[model samples]
Target: MQLPTTDIAIQTDRLTRSFGSNVAVRELNLTVRSGEIFGLLGPNGAGKTTTIKMLTTMLPPSSGAATVAGHSILCDSIGVRKRIGYVSQMISADGALTGFENLLLFARIYNVPRRKRTQRIDETLAFMGLTEARDKLVCTYSGGMIRRLEIALSMLHRPEVLFLDEPTIGLDPAARLQVWKRLKELLETFGTTILLTTHDMEEAEELCDRIAIMKEGVIAAEGSAEELKQRAGTESMNQVFIHFAGEFSDSKPNFRDINRARRTAKRLG
Candidate 1:
């Protein structure tokens, strides 16, 4: 059945995906409203990335349907792609290129008008605090700087909904905080609705207005951080994750693996 929609930014109905005998995501029904940060929390191989791939039109679902930014993933994938931005865990910035060069490249890729590309890139660079480093090669940037650049690249087209898969996987606390700050600013500046997957409970608690915990390919629980904590009877988001997600692990290549793989794929692409 279709999920009820009210001021919705994203909605999925019975969305399922499988690999032969394995069912990665099973009949997911979800709704994310406009202008809110929604977190998708799950253990490794719990279908977080799979769901993202399907929703973002990177992978087709085995059954069911989804709409992103009012465009169907299956029938109007291109339309969906045009209205949303996605930043995977992978580092998308070209280390061999300067930060400015990277944004210029992405601007062209996003088909930003030639008349607006330079101004847009500059504004984005300043917004992400990368103006000073714009001329520097991305190879020399810190992990946080690289992450910020990736986010900036995704935002060059000014998407209405941004999907982030493990956006802050391997950063120091300070770097993570910086990324968190920029994300909040992005939400306020663009009113972009964000849906992100992360293993970090602190990141989820800090950035998400609401969170959904998935276990074994289905949503086990969902709510605001405090509401979930109340349901789990704990103050710790970690404990809440444990209670909902359990210790399940899988052999499927996890998001971190995909992050590194995509870096290599970009080199080969």
Candidate 2:
């Protein structure tokens, strides 16, 4: 038996970004297939977030271009946004709004029909294990709870592609595992194309079908976790990252700080 081939969900060519004096990302080329999990692995100042922002149509690239689900980010940002959901690292909610309230508001913003919005909100909350905390103010929710709620909000629109920027940044090990489990189910059930940025080797190895390792605004290396490790003659993904990112690279950005930025952006997402 033969199955039909799926088209690429994401494609970028010579993608570049700069902040006046500093080039954040440069000449980066990549592609992500439909229904697959693609991971971007990079340390701080390595341009992972910048690439994500450009691809998601949040930030315009300084040069080059990309397409998400067939809409060119440079030409049809609105069309691109319509087909994708972005879950930033920071929780996106008004502190005063309860979990249920925030979800409802986003549903309306995403244009989920008025009639189906309520049921959709309830279902998403339950799926994220946020149903019990639905009515509690976001200010009162713990870090993990808030993270889960943010994910639920991103899924409300049932987007064909989901961009998760360090989606489990603040979670504990157990909570992170739970998140991965939920994400796997979402990919299988909805055929969602997921693109996430992370420096965590274990997270990349477990959740990503393929990974692109970025350094100094370019792709240093890319492949499956095992393939990269083998190419580097290393025993683990961490070793592979270290090899490609280079030795004595103080110029590289801090991943921990980058993770914090991810959390902060969620509020803006």
Candidate 3:
């Protein structure tokens, strides 16, 4: 059966994925309203990335179904890909290429018409605050600059929805704030719906219109930041996560793991 379209930008019904006896995501169902910033928060291996991979069509679901931008994931994977832009946790830019060159290349890859390609690239660079550095090689740019350039590349095709996996994961405080600022601007300027996955509690609370907290391959809690805090009887998102996912123990990796992952990704890149 075809999934019915509604006002929602994305929806899933009993979406699941498993590898042998191990289920990465179990009977997942979610609705993300159009033009809203929705955050998916979870600990490592809680199925956040697995869910994103399925929605983005990088991996097919083991069972169940989903729709993105009114296109069924099962029947129209290409349609979903055309309407959404994705920025993975790993950076997706060529360090050897100048920022402008990178955007121009993606423009061609996305099949932007030759007449409109230059205008689109220039607009994206200015929107991302990289016009001044447009001629500089990406290798010399700061962590935040690279992130912004990646986002710019994703926006080249003018996707209706943006899927961001840890968009601000490894930057310093100032750079993180700058990324947030640009994201908000994008939201306002383009009215783009965003599905974000993040480990930072404060970032989720600050940016998301609604959030779903996942644990053991299921949603443990869902609501606005204030509603979640009220339900947990706490004043902070950190405490709310603890209340829902249980306390973080020494057995689990901490923020240091995120740092290590960033370093490893950089080295691999």
Candidate 4:
């Protein structure tokens, strides 16, 4: 069935992925509205990353179908790619390059017009609060600064949808807040639909318009934070997660866990 209109940024119908006998994602159906901040919350090995890979066209589904930014993932993969930006768990900025240089490089890679490149880079830097450090080498940046720069690079081409896999991982509380602030601004300024995967319950509660909790390759629950709390008969997202997934981690998974999961998934593949 066709999605209603431009109001839908992403839609999936019975999307599934398997690694040998292990089903990483199974019959996953989801929809994200335009200009909304949608969160995918799950613990380690819960298939959040696998879902993202499928939507971003980094991996083909074992069965089923999906559409991103009005293009079919199966039939119009390039069209889907061109309309969306993905910021992976791993930072993509070059440490040797200055912040501005990194933006310039991506602008070129994204085929930003020659005449518009400099202006777009400056605008994105200022928007990301990186203008002051625009010429500083990325290696000199703080974790928060690097995250903002990575996000800036992703936005240079003005994609209709942005996928962020653990965008604030490894940052302190203050840095995480700053990133959240910028993300809200991005939505207001550009109306870009954001799909994010995060283990941080607080982050999801604060930033997401809606959230879907995944467990054992299926969606266990989905709703706004308040709705989830009501459903779980709890006062917090943490409790909500525990109620649905029957698991809890005091500390959210970090980059190490993310990498380890990827490696394991690759081995299975």
Candidate 5:
């Protein structure tokens, strides 16, 4: 189906980013519609996180352009930042502060009014099921609790666009499911535009309205998992992944071959 002609939460035009000698992301063009969940799926080192950073305005693009919530990444970074919330791969919180305190601090930073901050904090705490444990120091919170609080922190500002990088990266299956459920609830309740990166095919299938499969810093395929499976004449997303994986392997250097060549060059040196 064609994307709706409503507000676009994110749009990128040939977005590229590079380090000194290596390209991290290349010509990554994407659009995330308002009120939809968009998933960026790739294997490790496939530039999913790099592309996300650029889209979130955490990293400036080396070339091309992007806009978040209709604000340009280069020309209006602060405006983009105001309309977007980002959760990095690792949880960021003050271990010394209580869960409630941490959230209150963030509310202050986000410039939420003092009168409204308390109510918003309470709402988020209850929403994330952290109300009972709100007084406990972050150091005492469990992995699941910390993850929930991290998400709550990002959402406190009620941003139009939310970016989550590897949200369930190290969780148990039960915890992962709980997080997914909460994410669905949040989106349904608030109609927030979400962009997430994940290595788990099942997670993307379960949660994403659309999926983009990336490889070697560029999009390899895109569509719903079912759509991709149908196009590839397969019955499962795994089969589709396998088909694309084989194709990508043919174009990229073999890791083993590259390692052997490196050893030979070292010896010659």
Candidate 6:
């Protein structure tokens, strides 16, 4: 089935992934409308990261199919990659470099035209509110500042879709809100469709236009945050999350999961 490019930025048809016997994602059929913030809400190990990897072309799906920006993830991976920008949970900016230098590096890596590189970098910095700190070393930046710079790097290429995995993971509330503000402005200014994963209920409620709640590798509920709250008979997204995902079963994250999360937080903290 084909969708009009103007209407949909992402679509998946029973997309699945597995590592040996562990099915990280199972038969995920999802659609993200153009220029909207679509969130996948779940706990750790809920397959959100795996789904993102497949959509961003970093991990090939074990089965099923998907498309981004009107390009097939299976048949036209390069095309899918070209139209999207991704910010992973791990930090990507070089701390050794100044904010401006980091953007310049990404501009080159993304193959932005030399003539447009400086202009693109400047525009992205201003949009992300990083222009004043352009010459500051990334190591000297706050967690929020580094995250914004990472976001700016992703946008330097002017991608149509941006994928975020655990965006704002280790930031303080004020910083998280700041990032959310910039993301809202990004939609208004560039009309870039955003797909993000978060375990933070407040973050989802604050930033997402629509959300899919995942449990054991599948969507248990999906709708606007308000719609979900209504469905779950509550006003809080935290309650909505618990109503759908928490009551299911028991299995705490293992030591590996705990350690991985700590490392990510340490880096971004």
Shift in Å, residue 266, candidate 2: 14
Query: Mind giving the per-residue lDDT tens digits that candidate 4 earns over 100-134?
Result: 89998898889999999999999999999999999
lDDT at 183, model 3? 86
Model 2 CA deviation exceeding 4 Å by range: 1-6, 250-259, 262-269
Q: What is the C-alpha RMSD of each candidate to the true structure, in Å?
A: 3.4, 3.6, 3.2, 4.7, 7.2, 1.7
Q: What tens-digit string does per-residue lDDT give for candidate 1 at 47-146?
A: 8889999999999999999999888999999999998999986667899999999999988888999999989999999999999998999998888888
lDDT of 3 by residue, 180-242 (tens): 998888889998889999989989998999999998788999999999999999999999988
TM-score of each: 0.92, 0.91, 0.93, 0.92, 0.88, 0.95
Residue pairs of candidate 6 with colliding backbone atoms: none
C-alpha lDDT of residue 247 in model 4: 62
- Which one wins by TM-score: 2 or 3? 3
11: Cα error in model 2, Å: 0.1
Ranking by lDDT: 4, 6, 1, 3, 2, 5
Task: Report the lDDT of model 5 for residue 9.
Answer: 84
- Which pairs clash in model 3? none
How far out, in Å, is residue 267 in model 5?
Answer: 40
Candidate 1: which stretches are off by over 4 Å? 1-6, 248-269
Model 4 regions lying over 4 Å from their true place:
1-3, 248-269
The stretch of ten residues in a row with the least summed lDDT in candidate 5 is 260-269
Clashing residue pairs in candidate 2 (N, C-alpha, C atoms within 3 angstroms): 44-253, 90-263
Clashes of each: 0, 2, 0, 0, 0, 0
Better of 4 and 5 by lDDT: 4
